[model samples]
Target: MSSINTNKKNTITWLLLLLFTVISVYIGEVLELFTTQKSLFIGAVLFIVFLKGQQIIDVFMELKYAPKLWRRLLLGYVILLPIIIGIIYLV
Candidate 1:
């Protein structure tokens, strides 16, 4: 039963990641022509990237059940990028 649930969770994660990838691609390719707000789309793409990073860390890395310290160590990098982007944009 546990294995079945894990499989289901993994499948769902994979699908969600795929969906995010599609959305990211759409924003990068299709949406650019329709919108003039470059920062907004860039921010949206960054948010999606952050989501993908979290998914990769927690699911693909099998760190969902890991120790808090270890998880935070990896997640910190994922979390840091958006802040850095924000800083760059603000300056």
Candidate 2:
């Protein structure tokens, strides 16, 4: 019974991730239609990347139950790298 519940939860999480991906793509397309600022578009895309990365790390990587330091390090890497890239692009 518990296994069935776990499977359902995982399925929901995966679907949510898929929805986020679709939303991200749609957002990118809309941004392109209305904006000519490369930096702004890149920043929005990077923010979506961060959201996806965090979801993958927490759910697929099974890092939600990991030690605090490990989770922090991995999530930090996922977040910081994109911010760095965006900054580099802006500059």
Listed in order, each prediction's TM-score against the native is: 0.83, 0.84
Model 1 misplacement above 4 A: 85-91
The prediction achieving the highest TM-score against the true structure is 2
lDDT of 2: 0.86
Model 2 lowest lDDT segment of ten: 1-10
In candidate 1, how many Å is residue 28 off? 1.5
Q: Which 10-residue window of candidate 1 scores lowest in summed lDDT?
A: 82-91
Tens digit of per-residue lDDT, candidate 1, span 6-60: 8998999999999999999999886688888778777888889899999999998
Give the candidate number with the greatest lDDT. 1
In model 2, the runs with Cα more than 4 Å from the true position are none
RMSD each, Å: 2.1, 1.8
